[model samples]
Target: MIDKQIIDSFKNLIDGLDVDEVYKKAIVDFMDTYDGNNTNEFYSMLVAVSGLLVELKDLRIVEHGYNLIEEESEKTQDELDSIIRQFKDLNDGKLPPDPMVSTLEEDQVTD
Candidate 1:
């Protein structure tokens, strides 16, 4: 009854999307509160949005979900790497470890 091609197609689509981190976080949150049944519109929408979490459990669907999760994890890693890189100072090799605090004395000295 389940269409393998359909599931595979959906998985490919999700895998190619740039929406992995949010998708993973959303899915985890949804699962944390999921009741193994769909009674709320929110849950239905959450599942519907993800090719992996769709209302099917066929092999193709599983593959799609797997690909989606893999892509998302990769994307998340890339984003984290970029963010970390952004904070590095190439010239000085220094990065702000905490919020900066300015006082009246500092301003007066500049003036």
Candidate 2:
């Protein structure tokens, strides 16, 4: 009984209510860099993302789930960085240095 366009517009309005500017920008950036030729990586990421969406829906965290994910990630990163800095402060300057990089002292000693 409802107009098709009206129904479609209402659906879009509901679907887009939670999507803000940052989400739009992220989608644009990701799509801009997406490699269509790599079907394997594409499907892997697709499955992972879809699974997360389903889980979020099951948990009733549908609309605000995206914000929660980012907030939790940032909080985790900050905590990890604090721990790393504490370890570095307690230990010498060589507390878990990058294995891939060669320091000047090491390079000189190797020669």
Candidate 3:
């Protein structure tokens, strides 16, 4: 069985592999500021897990026959926004933007 830390590290590494310079920077910036010990690495794990969830959902869409990316994106965004709000609410309502990097941007960076 893969260790949680190893999984997390791999996730973080994948998350940081975004091609779009700006998006890559955004994700990295968040991970960089993340307080791993504060909430048992909740924020960091949230980012990684959320991303993996999106990918898995996408795969299901491709294999199981569904076109729910738009709907799923909205729902996911809502949840992410709420999480951002939680951090902001605890920190005087100031919040950063999305932490996930765009695959389009990453592809562009690669090409």
What would the per-residue lDDT of candidate 3 be over residues 9-104, giving only the tens digit for each residue? 845764655344555456556555555555656555667756865676577668654456667888889988877676776588544565544445
Of models 2 and 3, which has the larger lDDT?
A: 3
Question: What pairs collide in candidate 2?
Answer: none
**Prediction 3 global C-alpha lDDT:** 0.61
lDDT of 1 by residue, 10-100 (tens): 4465555555466656655544454444346543564567656343335656789999999999998997786566555433677656544
Q: Against the hidden true structure, what lDDT does model 1 obtain? A: 0.57
What lDDT is reached at residue 40 by model 3? 50
Positional deviation of residue 86's Cα in model 3 after best superposition, in angstroms:
67
Predictions in order: lDDT: 0.57, 0.56, 0.61
- Candidate number of the best lDDT: 3
What TM-score, over all chains together, does every model reach? Answer: 0.30, 0.31, 0.27
**Candidate number achieving the greatest TM-score relative to the actual structure:** 2
| Per-model C-alpha RMSD | 17.1, 18.6, 23.6
